[model samples]
Target: MKNPVPLPAYLALCLLLLSGCAAAAGSPGSAGPPSSASSSVASPPGGAHAAHHGTETGSPAPAPAGPSEAARMVCGDQPMDRLTAILELKEKPHTVSNWADSTFTCTYHLAEGTLRISVQQAPDEASARKYFDAMQALAKDAKPIEGLANLGFPAYETADGSAVFQKDSFVLHVDASALPAVAGPNAITRNALAYQLSTTILACWVEHH
Candidate 1:
């Protein structure tokens, strides 16, 4: 089978989160190990006919692709769906790309602009903070986001329209190219939305554990 196309960095992040959601939910397809982007898209169906010697003799079977079992446990087959519902978006959500079990990302088409949500695993709280710190330079009107580090996760928002935060063993990042009505004015809306999404995701992660 051909290798699956790698998703853009922003989209890839959403995919990673979706995959983690799948694993957390105990979905069988994504259970054993991290699945690559190719495996995610090219998965064979459950009832694929087998050739002698257990070889896939005919065309590859089509696997029912969606979020990993882990993702479903918290946010159903698509984590973005939960986000869209929260954002009260009118456009449909679609997966941009993903990596082997590590991350999942999706884009929500809106009149304002594309909104991307990425979720990834972090080794520790410190590691996630370090990563966030490094990206701080990009903040145009950088301001510390409140109520996150107090919970053991440090967070920040940039004037340029981005929000980042870490929680437990996961990091959440959000980028908005254009302002959505739901996000409100200035960074307030964007940061608030980021806070909401990160907290919700953290809650789900906690529930799974």
Candidate 2:
């Protein structure tokens, strides 16, 4: 009979074989350098998948389209609800009060100047006319505003029915001069100037009366 190895020696030999097999593969004591494949295997699921992702395969998320190329976007969101604009005046409380109803924008256009006044009225030519009337009164007495420099002003009414209150949209235009040292630069101001005039005139009236 062939000589048989001792039991302990056989067990040791099995352990050595297992250890060597581990080294060949990428187990704990493996000798070969780590490969990309082995690293992926070592990595956890989510991280590896995210790292090696390709471009979106199918049905990718859509992008938002930008603003439309139009001259102006009107009424994308305008309120249907109605509101009034008010100019708080002092001395001419009754005249100012006349404007206080259903306040809205009233525009006055003149060859030399213009007036934009906020007042109350229903939506129509008639209300707009009344609003203009109130603005005219305010303009005749509008004195020197605090900040505006070198200002010479007079409130004149336009025979042309350009300035009026409307049921819906109201626009008031006024020609406010800078009172140039040379009378050179004349400009038509916007809403704020008109507002300022209205405020100043009314406030002064309030202070006086």
Candidate 3:
């Protein structure tokens, strides 16, 4: 070192060293604490993050209930179709159903008239027989139905074209009196219609049982 450096040159060299040190500190590869935004993570949409944590955000919907057993017996497709065919209806009848106090009733509104079917379920066979016998006794000019005895025990038709019968703990009544009278030679009467309807319902009961 023969000659000393000038004061301005020495100052400029010191400033260049200071700027290099500052650039190194701010470099992308430098080891430093992460910023607040860089350290935080965002969750996915539609509760997916909650699902990932094995948590239940909500419960699935429950399934709908089905029709009751008694309602199915009279209002089912088979019996309804049979009634439509027997009445010679151009279109399906409008139907109304009611269930109360162990009794199920279905009413069919046909083009010409109304047809009603009622089923009363007793606690036991004996109770059903007693109720049916009382009803039979109260009927005016009730006659025992010959062919349908096998379908329902002591089946009968009332003077008003209502068919009544009992099987086990069930008593069924079919009332077709509101229908118009059949006029043609081969036309079916209301009494016969009631009997046919009763047969169909009893067949359904046997199949299900």
Winning candidate number (TM-score): 3
Ranking by lDDT: 3, 1, 2
Give one digit per residue, the lDDT tens place, for model 2 in 47-151.
212222332453322211211111001001100000011222122211110111122222323323333333222233333344444455444333322222111
* Model 3, span 150-185: residue lDDT tens: 333668887667888787766788888887655113
Ten-residue stretch with the least lDDT total in model 3: 21-30
Stretch of 10 with least lDDT, candidate 2 = 74-83
lDDT of 3: 0.55
Each model's lDDT comes to 0.45, 0.24, 0.55
Runs of candidate 2 exceeding 4 Å displacement: 1-122, 141-171, 179-209
Q: Candidate 2 versus the native: TM-score?
A: 0.19
TM values, all candidates: 0.52, 0.19, 0.62
Q: Give the candidate order by descending TM-score.
A: 3, 1, 2
In model 1, which range of ten residues has the least summed lDDT?
A: 43-52
